[model samples]
Target: MSRVADVKDEARSRLRWFAVHGVVRFFAERGIKIGDPQAKLIADPVTRANPGVVYQEIRDRGKIVKGRVAYLTVDHGLIFDLLRSDDYRTVVVGGNLPKPLRAIERRTRTAALHPLAPPSLLSVEPPSHTRYRKLVSSVFTARAVNAMRDNVQQVADTLLDELVAAGGGTVDIVSSYCAKLPVAVIGDILGVPEADRDKVLEFGELAAPSLDVGLTWSQFREVEQGLEGFDGWLATHIAGLRDNPGDDLMSQLIAASEDGVYLNDRELRATAGLVLAAGFETTVNLLGSGINLLMNNPDQLARLQDDPSLWGTAVDEMLRLESPVQMTARVAKGSVTLEGMDLEAGDLVVCVLAAGNRDPQVFDDADTFDVGRSNANKHLSFSGGRHYCLGAALARAESEVGLRTLFDRFPHLSSAGTGIKRDTRVLHGFRTLPVALGEPATVSA
Candidate 1:
């Protein structure tokens, strides 16, 4: 064929691929049938806000409604069943990597895996998942997180001081406070050097989208580059810790690997990467969302300010009301029945965690944010079953201390600027929250 003819053929092929993968795949992920007129509703922020409406519609249609590309479940009971059952599984990457990314991996032959790289906890099933979970589960237990309370508090205090210093008590809380606290706490937990904490924050945010399925080609490249940079740095640090073990979680995990806990070098890199990356991003979103919730809901904010003891429950309520992780997907492994819907092997099951948290059948005044709600812990913000968040305790501790400190330090805090919401489909939170730390200036005498 002539060169011009070959180029024209390649252009046609590119168009065909985008039509199939880009347009079709995006709609399928949202649980819309190809001919559905209601597809536009999914793109609307007002409609998206109450995922319960879509969830209930899907539930009403069937236990599982098969979209063009995947099956979806929003029924609270079905979601829990799917999460806990071995019948369903997770495919973290889902073939989203661009050709160039795959080519780069083949050429580089690096031992380092992206933090969201497959076979890690977020992607694999047991016995691999079981083995990986066992390696660090003990250290992430409630007891371990409790032991770090003073450190967490100290980090929150230090960040608050910085917040007060910046913008003269008028600050963007997401940057000046929420964004910093989690990384500092997780950094301290993983024994990251003080000098490197800022990089961890930078990399954590950049690499977080690796957890989602909707990456554009450009996004895939950025995610890959960020993961490579962070993972490369992490690999060197991990090697040093392996040789000179310390009291930090990284050293402990490395020591365990040496003592025959059975983690390969690649697994070691992915594990540490996952811990710092996942721990940092989710907790940051949690704190940011929690602050957004309280800022908008003055009554609940007042309740926490008055009692102080309600901070724990208040955090849970925030998680329930504005879950950091709005949705996650699973794949069915075999023929099975779910709430009257039958599924064959290879069916994708998208679980709407945020929707389930708002199911009226589960909680009283499910839509309302009640800090004193007794059942707030039942929220699946940390997920459920074998795939539950490994750092749940640490996330809770960080947010509790962070919130308690912020409110205590600035009881008169109020919104000073329009908050900016993050434009993301998977992780939900504000990108910026501007607040005044003290009472508004009174008239001069």
Candidate 2:
């Protein structure tokens, strides 16, 4: 029986907890009585680009109302009912997604990578329809990814080799050391013909920012221009597959003549771009975030070195604490009441992974980085539902191998240049991480 005025005051005090619609949705669906009404702000064109992180108000009965619920803030996990409930039902998360994401159906957005596009490919969904999951899943399958490790190692090694060859001095790790490995590796796996890897990587980097419909024409144009070559390249490659299929993903999609839900040429091309971009983009962030944790928290790094077993747990802790991909937006089915806020059809919900992973109720010290923390892998970084990161295992393997090798090799490793800096919070990757490689700390093969 909380009155609207009281509810508004409480909601405002707790504003830090919610970043966007997640705050409103979380409270409304839980039946919390708050005067805060569902709304969005449109002060500038760019506001629409960051739908999840951005907020605004709607007029209710000619009175200014509540739309600035905190979705990105850490506290949303503490008070929001749906977010705090143990039931853990998956809700449709919308907003903060690219305009292309709008093309995906609501039901399949978080849980499955449908024949069509799904919401921000980062949501944690439980894919019950394993067939659809299976169709395009092989690209990230173990066998396929294992084929790329030596290649990844080569990429990692080559970057290091060049740095080490340059008298083993300080180097800009982001560009020279960390950034290129995953980009190059995924580029190879996606069958991005040798000729276009660089351009493909450029697109991958360009597209990693939070999808914003409010993107500047320049930003939108950047992707359009970058993708022009990418789409054409995929068309040519798939054509070759039609003439002669091979063991690669392009061939698999092409070879599925029947009983298999094959992607149309458009889906094939879009997914091709998405797969490469997602695979490399997330892993690159993982590497940056993990290495940053180790460098900043010396004790953890010491523990990792002392007991190599801790490496795996430390990486899990890293992912939990600083999820590479922050939050993803999902759309609702028809109309839904979330925490007392009545959402209409086509309304969007944003789920902040960083905030959820840090929910006070979920983890003992959600803020702290504890490599030894158990159940750390349960964090929503890879998500739980259907659309879980298909390449999670591969990403795990890559992180373990990459970080372990880097730290183990360079026992005396220390970064040069300024400490790592990252403007793009979406990917959470280091712009420049300068580190000197230690004496080949190859833990094992």
* Candidate 1 segments whose C-alpha is farther than 4 A from its true place: 1-53, 59-63, 95-112, 257-259, 439-445
What is the lDDT, from 0 to 100, of the residue 3 in candidate 2? Answer: 98
For candidate 1, lDDT tens digit of each residue in 215-253? Answer: 455555566567778988888888878778778988877
lDDT of each: 0.73, 0.57
Candidate 2, residues 1-445, lDDT tens digits: the string is: 5698778644542331233223333444443233333222212223223433332222112211224432222333322433433333333334333344323323222222221234223332335235445666744567877776776676666666666567766766667656677776766665556677677666555554434222333443454445555556667766777787666666765555326456677555656656776777778788877887887788888988889998778878888887877655444445665555565554555555665676656788767888899878767777444556777876776788788777756777775556554434345667677776656544455
After best superposition, candidate 1 residue 131: deviation in angstroms? 1.4
| lDDT score for residue 343 of model 1 | 78
